[model samples]
Target: MRQWNFRYEDGEWLASTVPPADDNLTAAVETLVVPFGENLQAVESYLESWGRMERENGFNYSLSTPGAVARRVSKESVEICDLYDQFEDTRIPEAEFISLLRALSTAMRRGT
Candidate 1:
């Protein structure tokens, strides 16, 4: 399975399983557009909780298409699900997902 990762480069956010050496989303299998301002605050809150909304409920962020979402599937996993069958879902460990988001958030803040 491909290992998922995220980054912010040239003022755009990227999500992919590409290696850090690539540094671009050209090969990304999935992408999520995250806007600025209040959305950043929401991201911060999400980061603080690691997308855990409640005891049984977690987080679900839409992808580029309808029904496609990055969902918190378990205490240790986050899955990018394509509900319309356009593509296969991808899963990443929660710890790694949080780390990727944290780094991307910092990079976004630094304008890097």
Candidate 2:
């Protein structure tokens, strides 16, 4: 259910930032851990677990910065230092910002 790019010419699954030049995309995913998910998870987990109260407790991670709202993203799959971007606020493409509170609330309040 996830989309990714990779090269399989050699005996190993070579990782690269370059996209394929052909149209013969294959159904091969080198890793199940999603790239987007890594960013989201990093920010979400930090907000949910620890933060100075006002620093978003998972449900809300909106930090008013100089120009835009920045969020702390953390993930094991990615190098913690390189996972976050300063001006990477929720811009352009519309994507849902989910929180652990919302997910847990729904689960716990189900059938009530």
Candidate 3:
């Protein structure tokens, strides 16, 4: 059997190890692995929390999509509340949202 170790780079997938296929993924995992993103229940909780946050932030857009994405994120992995708080300032501007997201994404990587 053959096994492949995957690493994501530049918006694409990369295989670092070309090993014989085996039942085990490997002796160890260098990057972390999770069967699920953030647990469903956690995401739900985050959604509810975000709704309350939206009210305070004045961001009226439907949070349904963001809530869904939150499902893929571990609650403990991200301080979603922090991002929400930043949104409350309004001074960040729409263009800066992407920068904030990038920072938050980096934070997730670090926390994970």
Task: State the C-alpha lDDT per candidate.
Answer: 0.52, 0.27, 0.30
lDDT of 3: 0.30
- For model 1, the local distance difference test gives 0.52
TM-score of 1: 0.54
Per-residue alpha-carbon lDDT of candidate 3 for residues 1-112, written as tens digits (9 for 90 to 100): 2233343344322223344422222211111112114234433444456557555655433232321222112222221221222221112133222233333234335432
Clash tally, candidates in order: 0, 4, 4
**Candidate 2: lDDT over CA atoms?**
0.27
- The candidate that wins on lDDT is 1
Pick the TM-score winner: 1
- Please list the residue runs of candidate 1 whose C-alpha ends up more than 4 Å from where it truly belongs after superposition: 1-11, 15-30, 33-39, 49-68, 83-87
TM-score for all predictions?
Answer: 0.54, 0.18, 0.23
lDDT for 48 in candidate 3 is 59
Off by over 4 Å in 3: 1-91
List model 2 lDDT by residue over 1-112, tens digit each.
1122333333333323233312211111112112212243533553444346334453333333122233434321111111233212222111111222233223223421
Per residue, candidate 1 scores C-alpha lDDT tens digits across 2-27 of 34544666655656654442322222
Predictions ranked by lDDT, top down?
A: 1, 3, 2
Q: Deviation in angstroms for 69 in model 3?
A: 15
